[model samples]
Target: MRIALFNDYRIGSVNGSRVADITEVVDTRWHGTPYVINEFIAHWDQINPSISAAMDRADTHELAGVRLLPPVPRPGQILAAPANYRAHVSEMTGSRHRPANAQALLSPREVGFFVKSPGSVSGPSDAIELPPIPGRSFHHEVELGVVIGKPARGISRERAREHIFGYLVLLDMTMRTDGEHQEERTMRKSFETFTPIGPFLVTADEIADPTALRLRLWVNDELRQDADTADLIVGVDELIERASAVVTLQPGDIYATGTPDGVGPVEAGDTVRAGIDGLGEMSIPVTERGW
Candidate 1:
């Protein structure tokens, strides 16, 4: 079942044109102080049955009219992979004098992940606020976002799937610099409005294989990125296992599997549309940061 937060942070199950409201079910079941995304994810298993029953109710709302919020608005942590795709690494590192050699690939073990600030998270329909810094190159990295369902620490790769709640299409908005000794990678990616996630969170059961999905991104109708998860140097399972070994993975934490090749810069007024094969799509507008 596809779950979403729509119009005023209401919880619902999404179909093509309609959404079934399950807010009441969630409230009555969880009895939490505030009905936030974290609470929703924490009680997902308990409320799943109720949400399923509410799907057939007659008071569904039009999906298009509702404002879609990030599936997990305040994810405990936003862990992201960089150069996880061999082609992406080559594209970023390839020089005018020497072309990248695919044979010399660094495993996820070698190139560990970075944590994007949770404050960077924004809804899919939200505008990507371009930093006011002039001459800074801003790029879009479309990735598959993995939502964790339960708390886990040092989980085995074999059981990694058990911790995943579902998946969503994520746009890792970045700012590139030319200086040799630049700011830390995490700092570059932690700007507010840098991470755009959602459209919908498709439950794990719906995705037969997470590693075999197609990802694509378009900037103002221009296709800038197109690659399959199959091209990932380190797949989802290993990412989860490896990440958990460092820190305890909590419910609502998002693991953004790295982007594929075709990364490019985006300017103000450009609209970026990105998607994963079955998870769904997200279209985000771009705007200059008004300080």
Candidate 2:
């Protein structure tokens, strides 16, 4: 089922152009607090039996025309894997470092994960702010975001899919070479409005094979990255299995499973869109920020 968190944190179950305001059904019990998508998944079975029964319900209320937020407003953690795709690795090979050597030099073999500041999160229609930091280069990394459904630790690669709640398209906006420290990538990736996620969350049952989806990104309407998740060096199952070995994967945790080739930059007034088939798309505008 396609689920979305709309204006003012209202929940909706998508049906073509129409959106059923599950907000009433959801808010009837848990009122006043900002409801995150994870809350719906956690309580739907017990709180609303109708929701659990129908994936496509009719629009019950007037749809609110507003911006979509990252389904999880306050995810416990946002863990992202870098250079996990073979083609992306190939692109970074000659200049960044050879993929053969990255495993050791860049710690790719260590299962490296970068933590994006949760405040960096934005939605499909949100404007991406280009903070005027001199001598900086910003790049867009289109990634497939994985949302955790239940709490798990030390999950096996074979059973990883069982722990997944849903998927979302992610734009891992980064500020390359931020100069905070020459040794880390997080410096450029943790800026405000750097991550654009959503449109809607597609439940795991809808996507039978996560590794088979096509992922792509277009900058100002020009296709730059076009690669499938099948190109991933360490697929989703392995990523979850590996990450679980280090930290517990909570119900609201998010993991951006790396981007493919075609990494580039965007300035203010630019449009960036990324998506995965069967999942959904996210389009964000770029705006310059002074100071």
Candidate 3:
């Protein structure tokens, strides 16, 4: 089932062009505080039956006019892979005049991952705010976002799938410059409005294979990124296992499985649309942060 947060953070199950409100299905009073995304995911299994029942009811709203927010507005962590795609790595290395040696094509085990600030998260309708730093070129990295369903630590690669809640289309908006170093890379990436995720959170059961999906991104009408997840140097399972070994994967944590090549700079007034085959697509506007 497709789950979404729309029109004032109300949770609902999404059908074609319609959404059945299921916000009341789960008991949201968490010892006086309203149930947040993390609490909701913790109780998902128990509340799922009621959500399904709510979807069957006649009371529904049109999906088109509703405003959709990031499925998890503020996740506990946002783990992201860098240079995980062979083509993407090659493009970076060749452009920088680095030798395309075996050392350059590091595996996921070697490259590890980086943590993006949760404050960078934004929804589908939100604008990709371009930072005003001169000489900084903003680019879009379309990736398949993985949402964790349960808390896990040191999970095995064999059982990694059990922890996943679902998937979504994620755009890792970035600022790049020539000859950027490691520390500069993280600083540029952590800017506000850098992560745009949403449209829908497709349940994992609905997806046949996460590693076999096609990812595509466009700047206005021009296609900038086009590649398959099959090209990933380190697939989803290993990403979860390896990441979880270092830090506990909480229910509302998100992992962006890196981007393929064809990443290029975007300017103000550009509309960016990115999608994963079954998950969904997000089209967000780009605007300059007036300095």
lDDT of each: 0.83, 0.77, 0.84
Q: Estimate each model's TM-score.
A: 0.92, 0.88, 0.92
Per-residue error (Å), model 1, residue 52: 2.7
lDDT over C-alpha atoms for residue 258 of model 1: 92
In candidate 1, which residue pairs clash?
none
| Model 3 worst lDDT run, 10 consecutive residues | 96-105
Global CA lDDT of candidate 2, please? 0.77
- Clash tally for model 3: 0
TM-score of 1: 0.92
Q: Order of candidates by TM-score, top first? A: 3, 1, 2
lDDT of 3 by residue, 18-72 (tens): 8887776656664222235567787778877676666676367899978888888
- Could you give candidate 2's per-residue lDDT for residues 1-291 as a string of tens digits? 787777778777776766776665554545434555667766545645777444355454433465566677778789989778776766666544222333332323465677888788888867888988776767888989999987779999999988898998888988755333343567568787888888888889899899999988998999999999898877898888888988999887899998888998898888998889998877788899765
- Look at candidate 2 and tell me the lDDT of residue 92: 67
Question: Where does candidate 3 stray beyond 4 Å?
Answer: 30-35, 56-58, 96-105, 179-183
Better of 2 and 3 by lDDT: 3
Screening candidate 2 with a backbone cut-off below 3 angstroms (N, C-alpha, C), the clashing residue pairs are: none
